[model samples]
Target: MNQTIHKSQEKNMILERTVSADSPRQDELVPSRYALKVGEIDVMVISDGVLPLPTKMLGHNADSATRAAWFSDMFLPADAFDWALNAVVVRSGGKTILIDAGLGSDPDLHLPRAGQLIKRLESAGIDLASVTDVVLTHMHMDHVGGLLVDGVKDRLRPDLQIHVAAAEVKFWEAPDFTRTDMPQGFPDALRAAATRFTREYRNNLRQFDNEHEVAPGVVVCRTGGHTPGHSVVRLSSGGEALTFAGDAVFTVGFDHPDWHNGFEHDPEEAARVRVRLLRQLAETGEMLVATHMPFPSIGRVGIDGDTFRWVPAFWDY
Candidate 1:
């Protein structure tokens, strides 16, 4: 009896260690990447992990009681929660495009749970050198920091084209945080990350004024809300379409399109942009995915009377 008990304890310890975050990527307990097709374009939504942030960030302008009520209705903690971070890989016209690299590493930020993009990509058989283009919806650290990860630059192709809005690049030069309501130290960290990313990848940036096509059926259009140059990517081929909304819409925006996310540089404009996009998606019936939505973020927007509704797409598998 003693021997059997000891052996069981040892086995449990091994299992725990294997499932820990530091374990090999192959040992991950849950699926980290999801694949789907947008007409003829091949798309994959890879989980970059989650960012646990204060609940106040969800709707900084709302009254505390109202915000708490929303959280309660959603069955989420009223104080804080994890915000999903997702990146997409698109293949069309013989070109591979990456949308919004995940947050790399920021030790001082104490967000060690995120920055899993690179390893997850490798596990999914996506080679950095194979990426022909990168579409950045915005210049936020979480969206561009993955490229700044040590050794990532050396692995990427020298000819890789990074498509971003011209205004986004210019805004980062002297970023305005007066309208943002981020937590302490966020502004400084964001500024530093943007500056570093720009300096390091200046040669690869392909700036567009309003809209640009990075690949066949892959169009990125500037939205100018969350940031001075925030944008979203639209994928259309055959008869299907999907939009990868970066930071423009969040989990809460579906229910409260006007709630101001703390990360928005211009909260009011951000709200307007969210409502406009949701309305358009609802009318057209196009599929939607966003950076901060729950993983596999694929869904369709619906009109819920005066508000909006999120109808998650049924998993193909």
Candidate 2:
């Protein structure tokens, strides 16, 4: 296994650093804890750890210098231009549902360790046994690997209903998901993830043909841009509403909403949806939680002239 690189210094020179682990799990693996309330619904933003990813991976059209100028604070920790992985947890009508299960113990992949969802959920007094549902925004390595433990040990949400974008799943699991233009391990990892969506998981699994109320007060709507069948999960109750825009907007990624991520299946379509979704979120003024934004990634987008600005909310917990 590769060593986790950190910072270090010696007598009069700089020193390279790394974190070695006897076991896969590590403390503070996941940071960025927060929560919110939209009307009567309770929302929690759980950390899936942070990775200093390459800006090139974002697939933006801008040059490295321009991109760096745009996201000045994106280099908060290690002078890294990054997009964070933040998972959303929703509790309503006595039900607990996780929006996305982040990456597990996969180091070969650029993704980081984010299998702490179950532990963090348990810390919040949420019993894994009673987690009624798990709605995935998409089945990327970092999003769905948390469904099961490493080596496929146990079902994280045994009795919960698993929601997926049917077309997206088909594409990833298809024999040619990665042959043409997709990332290297996208298809292979997804195929392994099929086991997590077991017989019971599939029995409870569903796909949104159009807009449908998959759960009480929780509706799954088709919004394909990031992927072929990507969908947005929206919730409304007691006159207040919140939309979990999976990867539609990655922080200021929407600033250039027309900008697309490199990993996206359709850059043009993804760019189109990013602009359209940002416009909708800005115009509607709906509070949103996304799978990847900065830490504590739940906020509303505000319209500032043509571009929309991210308006972060204060999370009590």
Candidate 3:
């Protein structure tokens, strides 16, 4: 983690808030749940909620008609895509690590039926008060908004340790929330949110950097490109391992080494990181986890012909 002093100029905060984040409505509860075991670590996936976005959001080159066709095959709305948001919990070494908190704001897309991250924790009999750390994959609203309860004061647990990336913090600390191609009001919301982040809850924040091991069984790897300073987690106990790849690639077919969504800050660099991580994860042959991937997004990655494909876990709960 970066111990350097933070300079939260208005410029950087705008850039940071405009970046990518999980999209889901908070009203929904009873988040979908899935379990994976990595050695002695117990990993649980609590559903955050699901958002149906424009099908065109799939790929930059994909036009309206193309997106419609893709959605048509699935019998979904011609113009929409339903994406799921998940928060994974790993319990090992007596350290409870919760990766990516769910949606807290966004009333329009909020799933009055899906924001049960906390309830799921309760259902699993896991105590949120005991959770030691909150590791964010990225600071988009869906991922970090849960740090505080909506419209409530002093919501975050006092003892919880929050870790983010130095690079990500830098991006949001800049001024001018608007991106080059974003909509008009996008920049404004982003800018406002960044300042709120600094003023409201700066003390609990720690900028995660490099490959630091947060616990005896958990190690962090710098895997930016999805959002600047985006990081992935590696959990190992006994001899089993799991790599939590948060939004590096959304779908199996979309996991091309050379492919990247237009939203990426640097498309070329993002593509390179995609390939590198794919190769590394494949060689390890351990289970994988994804934030935006379908429910119970934990599984395996394999080489298919020339590209990689997600091999979803085979089991029914």
Candidate 4:
């Protein structure tokens, strides 16, 4: 009986090895794309790739024990967390609007696993030139880097209109806006990129100060916290709605709305905005699309006493 069992196990191991040899490497496999119907509009959630960040950077203000507890509870590794790089493409009103450009084409500066957005879009049959407008959520490198290709800014396509928050432009443009929160050389890099973008687009770049509609079914609202001009986009058609919460919360952020991320310019203000937004989302039952959450980062928030909980949206075909 023992010999028979051992032979069966050996056979199973051989079968597994054969299957593994036939399968493609994980990195070579095409990333999954997700889609949802918002009334008549089609929303595509494409992935740039996943970024591995230190777990300590998240919930920086929380106590060590609390952070550890949360991480352990979520079954996350203690040292690092895999953060998703997601961007939205909204097709409506005869316009193809990309909410945030993914990490730029370079693979060295960003994670090599990331920066596959352009290829992914092409695979989806989305013509690079068909993207009419790029609505920036903020000036973060991870969010706006895709606008540049081979050192040229706003080169994603020709005759494209780029929209950004006026306040965000002001914050990044100020000569003395240097701060410790930004990565080293970030301010200079931003300045250089901004210069190129302005020169390239010129009259085509539009900056707005307050809440305003950018398209027939899209509007931008200032939700300052992560940055002075960090904003969210509201996509609504018919009665369905989804708010693109830009860095408003990372994974497990909904569970601790008061916890501040290390990258936040104003930690206090960020916490306040998060608490307010989480509560509103929980009560209203509106859908949220977060850039840093897991891939296909669409979900809903639910009230959990003073805090909130993240409920990932069900995958629908």
Provide the lDDT at 129 for model 3: 76
C-alpha TM-score for every candidate: 0.92, 0.79, 0.79, 0.84
Q: Summarize candidate 4's per-residue lDDT along 1-317 as a digit string, tens digits.
A: 99999999999999999868754456657544789988777899988888777776787778889899999999999888787889999998888998888777543444677676777777677887888888888877677777666644443566777888888877766534322244345556656665655565556678888787878879988888788888988888888888888888787777787777866877788888888877878887889888888888889998868877889898886
Give one digit per residue, the lDDT tens place, for model 3 in 1-317: 23332544555776656542332234333336778677878888888777555554455554556555656765767655667788888887788888987765653443464455665666677776778888887766667655545642254467667777888778777753221233234445545655576567678777767667777788877787766778888898888888887767677244435544534565566667777777777788888787778887877778765688778878656
Q: What is the C-alpha lDDT of each candidate?
A: 0.93, 0.67, 0.68, 0.78
The model with the greatest TM-score is: 1
Provide the RMSD of all predictions against the true structure, rounded to 1 decimal: 4.5, 9.3, 15.5, 5.5
Candidate ranking under TM-score, highest first, comes to: 1, 4, 3, 2
User: Which regions of candidate 1 are displaced past 4 Å?
Assistant: 1-27
Q: How many pairs of residues in model 1 come into backbone collision?
A: 0
lDDT of 2 by residue, 186-260 (tens): 556656665454432556667666576756788877777677778888988877778888877776565666555
Residue 38 Cα positional deviation in candidate 3, in Å, after optimal superposition: 0.6
- Sum up the clashes in candidate 4: 0
**Candidate 4: RMSD over Cα atoms?**
5.5
Model 4, residue 12: displacement in angstroms?
21
